[model samples]
Target: MRLQAEDGDEQAAIRAELEARAVAGTLQLDAILALSPAAPSSSEFDFLSALGPVQRQQALRRLLALLRNEEGLHVGDASRLADVSSPNFYRLRQLWRGRAKSGLGFLSGYAGRPTRQPRGVGALGTLGKLAAENSAFELADRSIRGLSKLIQEEQSARIPAYTLDAAARHLRQNARNMPDVLAARYGFRILIDYCAVSLVASGSDGSLKLVEIAWVIEETTQLILAARPVLDVGGCVGQQRATRAARWYIGRCGLDVPGPPAAWIKAVVPDPVSPLDRHHVDRMVSVAGEEHVATTGARRFGRLVTDVIGPILGRIKIIPRATLSENTSAANVRAFGRDILDHQSIRARVAQSVIAHNRPIIDMLRDSRLPLLDAGDRTGTMTSTLNDLLLRKG
Candidate 1:
C-alpha cells in the first residue's frame, strides 16, 4: 500500500482507517482480551502490550492467521472458533486481534467451525433433581460438622509435655539443697509460674498459637462471667487486673473475641521483670518450666478435635469424558450421570473454603511457644547419659 504523507489524501485516509481498526481489535479480539491489560496497542508494533515480546509476536501471528482466513465469520462464530465470548471479541475490535473487522462482529476473511446446536443433556436427565438435592444435603451436613469440630479443636489444649519438661528443667537446675521428692514439688510449682508468664507474654505479643489464643479468650470470658458477683472482693485483685487488662487489650486492638482476634493475646502481655534475687529468679524459672509442660497437652486436644470433625467436611470430585455414549440403559445412565457430576470448579471452591476456615488452626501449628518436642527429648536424653558416664569415671 502507498504510504501516507503530511498532506491529507487517500493514503492518509486509509492510514487513519487502519489505525482505527487496529485500536478496535480488528481480528483477534478474543486473543487480545485474553492478553494482560498491558499488551501492545499498535498493529505495526507487532505485539500485544500485555504480553511479553516473544509471546506478543506469537499472539500477532495467531491473530494474523485468524484475520487471513478466507471463510467469513460472525462474532458468535468467531468466538466459538477462538473459545472466547462474543462480547470479549467486540471489546477487542480496536485493541488488536489479528486483522481488522471487515463487518460488525463478522470476520470478513475467515472460515472456522460452523455453528451447531448444543449437545443434549440426556445423561444429566437420569439423575434429575432428586440426586442433586440428596448430594447437596449430605455435603452440607459434613461440611458444617467438620467445620465445628475444627474450630473447637483449634481453641483447646490437651497435651502437657511442655509443661512437664519445663518443670523437670527447673528442678534439675536448683535442687542442690532439696530432697528428690521435695525437688519434684518445687519443679511442679515452677511449671505453674512459667505457664503464667508464658500466657502473659503470649497475650501481650498477639503471638499465641491460634488454638491457645482461642482457649485463653474462652477461659477469660468464662472467668469474667463467673466473677460478676465477686469483682469487688479483696482477694480478686490479680484476677480483676488480668480481666481488665485483657478486655482493654482486645478493645484497643479493635477486635471482637472468639474470633481470630483471640490470637492477639500474646501481644498484650507485658515483658518479664528481672529477678529480684537469685532465689527469686530460680523460683520464677522453675514455675515457668512446669507451666510449659502442662500447656503442651493443649496441642493433643486440638488434634483430637480435628480428628473427630474432619469427616464432616464436604467433598466433591469431577470427572471428564470424551463424549456422551449412545447407550441409555439404567446402568449406563447411572454411571455416566455420576461421571458428569465430577466438576473441578466445585472442588476448587471447596478448597478455598477449607483454607479460609482452617487458617487459625494452621497458624497455631507454627507458634514458637509450641516447638516440636522430639529434638528436645533427644538432646536431653543424650546429655543425661553423658553426665552419668562422666560421674562414674570421676
Candidate 2:
C-alpha cells in the first residue's frame, strides 16, 4: 500500500510538471489554435513564403487539391500524387482548413525573398470615424504624433496570440496575478469605459447622454464581436456583456468553422483611470468557457484601454445590436431606435455612411513604388486592401 501511495504521488508530480510546462508553453501542441482568418478569401501563407519559387507554386496546387477532395481523399494517394509526405499533406490540409480561406492565391514571379511586408495600420484606417465619434472625441485636443503613439500603445496591448505557446506565455506573464482566470484565453479583451451616446436620437444634437461603454474587440480578427450597445455601468456586468458576446462570437461556426480561435477568450483589459474594476474578470474567464482558475498569484488588473471597439461601433451609423440586460431595458434605447434607428431617412443614408473609411488609398512613386487602382463606382477596395491586410498579418 505504501508503494502504491508513492507511485500515486509520483504520477501526480509528473502531471503537475506537465501542466506547468504547458502553462509556460515548453510543450508544443503543433499550434492548432490560431486567429481565424476574418474573411472568406486569403492570399499569403507565411510557411509558403519560405518555400522555393517552384515548391511554393506546387504547395498552393496541393493545398487546393486537398481542399477540393477533403471528403473522398485517400491520404496516401493524395500525398503520393502531390509528392509530399502523408504528414506534410495533413499539415497543409490543417492549415488551409484552419485559416478557412478559399485556397486560391496564385504565386507572383517577383520573389527575391520579400524585402519587407508593407506596414499594416488598422487603427489609422478608422481614424476619420473615430474623430467624428463622441466616445473618442477627446483626441480633438491631441496632436497627430500623440494620436499615433496612442494607437501604437493600443495595438501592442491587444496583439493576438497566434499559437497556443504564444497564448500560454502571454497569459502567464500578464495574468499571473489573476490565477483564478489564468487558464482562459481571450478572443477579445473587453474594457469598461464611458461613451457619449444620444438618448433621444442617433443624431448628435450638440448634447449627448453619457453611458458606460463596453469596448470589446477580438484581437485576432480586429473585429467587434458584438453589435449590441451596453447599458450596464459596473465592472462585473459590463464584462459579462462583453464576454457573453465573445462567447456568442466563438460559439458561432462560420459557414463551416474549421476549429476554434487561438486561446478562446473574451476578456476585458482593466483600466485604473476608468471607474470599472476587475471584480468580474473571474466570471469573464469562466463564461468564455474554462473550468479551472489558477490559484497562484494575486489577480492582475490595471492597464491601458485599447481604443478599437468604441470608435468602430460609433461609426457604424446605425446602432448594430444591444440588449445589455433585461432589467435595464433602456427606455432611451427603445425611443432612440424608433425615432432614428428604424427611420427611412436613416436607412437611406446608411449606404453613404457605411463605408466611410472604405475609399481606396493608392500611393504612387518612381521605381520605389508602382501604384494602380481598378475599381468601379461605390465599390471601395479599402476593405480588401486595408481591412483584411492587417488581419492577414495577425
Candidate 3:
C-alpha cells in the first residue's frame, strides 16, 4: 500500500489498504515477511527512527519473529526466517513474551542504561540554591576551577568541577529559580553607571567606534529604568554632557532642588576626577540633595559596568564588543548618538529591549510580595508640590 504524504495521519490509509488486500485474498504474509528487515514500512520506520541503529535492527528482527509465530510457523522455521540460531530464538521469544505481557514495552527503545536517578541529588539542589542566591554576574565570572573549589569549601565534599558548571548553567536557564532582591525602605534607589561600548557603522568603511552608555537601574526592584546612549560630539564624554543628562533625568522624575531626592542617585565615575567633573558631581548634589549623590570606588564600579550593564547591551548587539578597550576613539561619537535619538524607531527598539530585560525581574519582585510604589502615586505627589510652588510664584 502507498503511504500517505502527511505525517502522523497515514494510519487510516495503511489500514484501508491492508483490509482491501485481505478481502481480495491477495495479502501474501510470507512475501511481506521475506522483505529485508533493514528497510521497514512507513509506520515501523517512524516508530524506530529515534532508536539507535543496532536497537532498531534488533526490534525489527524480533517483530518479524513474532509475526512468524502468529502465522503458526514452527520454532525452527521462525528462527531460520529471523536469521537466528534455535537457542537464541528461544531467548528472544522469552524476552518478547515478558515485554508483550507488559503491553509491548520493548518498542519504547532500549531497556539498557538504568533510569537516570542522579546520585547526590540533594547536594546538587543545595548547590543550585547557593548559586542563585548569589549574584549571577559574580557566579558566571568565576572560573570553573574556582567554582569547584568554592563548592568543595561550602559543601565539604569533593564534587567534580563539571557538575558545578552544569548546575550554574541550569540556574541561568531558569531565571525564576534565582533569588529575589530585598525590598528597600524608601521605594527603590537608582544606580547610574557609565561604560564605553564598541560599535561599527553599517558601511564598507565601517570602523569601530567607542560609544558611552549610561545605565540607570532601580535598586530594590533590580529593574533597568533606562539605558541611554551618551552622545559625545566632541569625541569624548565631558562633564557638561554627563551632568546635563543627570539633571534632565532627575528633573523628569519631578524632584525639586533643596528638597528630598525621590530616589537615591549614585554615579560610578572614573578615578582621578577633574575639577570640572567635581563641579558636575556638585551639581548633582544640588539637584538630588547632598546625602543622595555619591561616587562608588573605581574597582567596584568596573564590576557593575562589566558584569551587569555590559552583558545586557551585548545581548541586543547594540554594543559590538563585550568590553571596550582603553584606546577607543571618541571622535564622531556624538554623530552616532544623534542618529539614535533622531530615529524614533531606533529609540523604540532600545526601549523595548530594556522592557524585555526588566519583565522577568519585575515578575520575580512581585512574587516576593514586596511593596512597590505606584508610578502614579509618586507622580501625583511631585505634581501637587510643583503646582503649589507655581501658585506661590503667581
Q: Per-residue lDDT for 1-394 in model 1, tens only?
A: 3233334475446434533444444534443323233433444332133232333333443343244222344666555444446676564454344333211112211111112211232222222332234333232223323433332343344324333222222222222212332222211110010111000111233432110111112211111111111111121222223344334332333222121111211111112243332233233234223333222221222221122222112121111111111222334234422222112322232333233333333233234232222322322221222122121221
TM-scores vs. true structure, each candidate:
0.18, 0.26, 0.39
lDDT digits (tens) for residues 225-341 of candidate 3: 555554433211333343334344334543222333354555554432556555555555565566654454433333443333323331233332322443334443432232322
Model 3 regions lying over 4 Å from their true place: 1-124, 128-181, 201-208, 232-265, 270-278, 284-302, 307-349, 364-370, 379-394
As a whole number from 0 to 100, the lDDT of residue 28 in candidate 3 is 34
Error of 3 at 367 (Å): 5.7
Candidate 1 weakest ten by summed lDDT: 190-199
lDDT of each: 0.27, 0.32, 0.44
Task: Give the C-alpha miss distance for residue 184 in model 3, angstroms.
Answer: 3.7
Residue 254 displacement (Å), model 1? 19
lDDT of 2: 0.32
Displacement of residue 170 (Cα, Å) in model 3 is 10
> Candidate 2, after superposition: displacement of residue 376 in Å?
37
TM-score of 3: 0.39
